[model samples]
Target: MKHKQAGLSLIGLLIVAVLLAFVFLIGMRTVPVVTEYFAVKKIIHAIAASNPSMDETTADIRRDFDKRASAEYVDSVTGQDLAVYKHGGQFEIGIEYSRKIPIVANVSLLLEFQTDAKSNGGR
Candidate 1:
């Protein structure tokens, strides 16, 4: 009777351990995806603020900013082109980042995450 009880308890412990391991693996896989999404969003916001006027020809300013921001980015999965333009009094900026998930040695999950932000240049 004691032996039967000990066997059941050990099996229960093993099941719980396996479940925890599975959850840990999933969390690890998802962390990079969430991180890249937010990083890209931050870059978009910075670009929008830096380019106040579409006609201002702010490439030098934007290039410097992109250099700093892109350093935080790993690599692009889709659009590498960053664009800035103006619509009347508002400034528009576009940023895109590519994200890749490794599923196999030769296959990957590729996605392009893009964001646009507009501002009217104010306090």
Candidate 2:
């Protein structure tokens, strides 16, 4: 009679461990960037929502965005980077930015983020 053992070999286990480690490392690098993106999006949405009357000037909007972005520790995209315009009687605010995260020697991950929100619609 022959019996077969079903389990991961040592080499297979090591390979799995290495792959998991790499995945974890990439995830760790990615989380903060994503967090910041969401924070920026929230800030823009809040600003737009609060000024639904569309009475605020573009300069005023930019200034408000700068203040809130600073508070949120979002330095990648500034108020100057925003695209502010009026459409359908609503203020539309948007931002596009790219972030580069270095993962290893001479290797990096680049991420692009864009968000647009209207004053009346909550996102």
TM-score for candidate 1, residues paired by index: 0.60
Maximum-TM-score candidate: 2
> TM-score for all predictions?
0.60, 0.88
- Candidate 2: global Cα-lDDT? 0.89
List residue ranges in candidate 1 displaced over 4 A: 1-8, 56-65, 77-85, 95-114, 121-123
Residue range 1-123, candidate 2, lDDT tens digits: 999999999999999999999999999999999999999999999988786555667888889999999999997888899999987678899998899999999999999999988887322
Compose the digit string of candidate 1's lDDT tens values, residues 5-101. 3345778899999889967866677678877677767766776665455455547436644675668773443233666666677667677666667
Return the top candidate by lDDT.
2
- Model 2 scores a TM of 0.88
lDDT of 2 at 20: 100
